[model samples]
Target: MSVKHDWYQSEAKVVITVLLRNAAEKHYAVEISGQRVHMTADDYELDLLLLHPIVPERSSHKAYSTKVEITLAKETGVRWEALEKPAAAAAAAAPPKAQAKNWDKLVSEEEKVEEKEAKGEAALNNLFKKIYSSSSPEVQKAMNKSFSESGGTVLSTNWGEVSKEKVTVKPPEGTEFREWDK
Candidate 1:
């Protein structure tokens, strides 16, 4: 069930005020983790993945007859744009030209895939993505054509070589690749 709630943040804390009448300790429950908040009052529920990290150990909630107020101590003094992280993430997805994601220290899409130390298939994929992203237009086109025409069995960055001929699928040893039936 939907319950009305108001959230605000100060330099030191984030406050969530749930409008729930007859709010009691037994009926209303609030749980605070590192950056997550889960509150329940009878049939109503409120969950928030906070925009910023909060000191869960120092957080607390008070229940009153008309409302239940939760106070979460902020780990840092950063003001939040939204009560939940998802809202903040969506807003950050399309950042302003000059203004970037420093507000949240959020990682870029490319950064998310490029790990510091990758291994095996992950490393290969990351390498391919990196190579493709940084390659010249000709190289990119060559790579795309080769990879696709070869059924993902070939990935070539040499435009001169790849453009000369159609890439034939090179199946791995012990594996057979057959054409799909019409």
Candidate 2:
């Protein structure tokens, strides 16, 4: 059989339940430290280091048919934000040891110039889109259809650098159109 344990906290205390199937009642032992809870069931031991302080004197436990329930009194009524300290946060909190800097991995002057040029191009493209969207509805619809049909790579010839041209409208001419004309 394997030993399993779970823990939860209430307004006043933290309760830990250990599942020990087919184990004798006298075979379990529970202990508490200033900020830790330890339990032994059959041959298995569980150690839980609490994030907050607890009152060992006020802590109690009860053994049931196949489980042991331990209640640890909270030193303060305030709820604990977490049960255990996060290992990643602890590692990040520590100041890194100073090391020699590597100049080879740094960004080159040419790359900086290219990055600035890319930003300027992006800003100009945004301005062009704003101007196109604020144009007349006919122009917007023609541009939308042109862009959709050509995957936006084919530019609209109606609008040029210094002049705005009108879109040519053509009626559909086919057998299906003649039948629908009725």
Candidate 3:
């Protein structure tokens, strides 16, 4: 199900034979590092979809059975080559320090922006609490009643309201009849 090999550059040829469970095998001629290698299947299970269905009566009578054969084409020329000298040297060289500096600056700016946003949110919350507390006692009572009935908590000091659930629901269907029965 999986293939693993050592690091190979662009041109590599390897021949591998995999033994399968169903007595079916596959041969692969792979090009590894510009070399062509031939691999033959060693007792590999054949894919059911690729295999012909066996007729039990005919098979019993026959001395030999038919098998499916698959051939894969190989690249004639050099499939892989080593990287050019100049490009390889440049890639091996150390990267510029400016990239790291820019990344650090970006991170610092993001943190500052997040801090400002959090401060603004706290200020807005405080303003809301002050306004809610300064309102008339009747308004405060009404707000508290609404908050409690809707599964919310109204803080005493700040008069800030926090609700457990955001959504409101309407009475269920046939509630009038149910109420009458009760």
TM-score of every model versus the real structure: 0.47, 0.44, 0.19
lDDT of 3 by residue, 21-131 (tens): 222324432222222112223422211110111122211110112332222222432442321223344345432111112445888788567556766767657565656
| Better by TM-score, candidate 3 or 1 | 1
Which candidate wins on TM-score? Answer: 1
Model 1 ranges off by over 4 Å: 87-182
* RMSD in Å for model 2: 16.1
Candidate 3 global CA lDDT score: 0.33
Residue by residue across 1-182, what tens digits does model 1's lDDT show?
Answer: 65677777889998888888987843878889987777776777766666778999999999888888899999999878877666556455332211113433455645665666678998888888989998899999999999999999998889999998899999999999999883
Give the runs in model 2 whose Cα sits over 4 Å from its true position. 22-26, 88-182
lDDT of each: 0.79, 0.64, 0.33
Candidate 1 matches the true fold with a TM-score of 0.47
Question: How should the candidates be ordered by TM-score, best one leading?
Answer: 1, 2, 3
Clashing pairs in 1: none
The better candidate by TM-score, 2 or 3, is 2
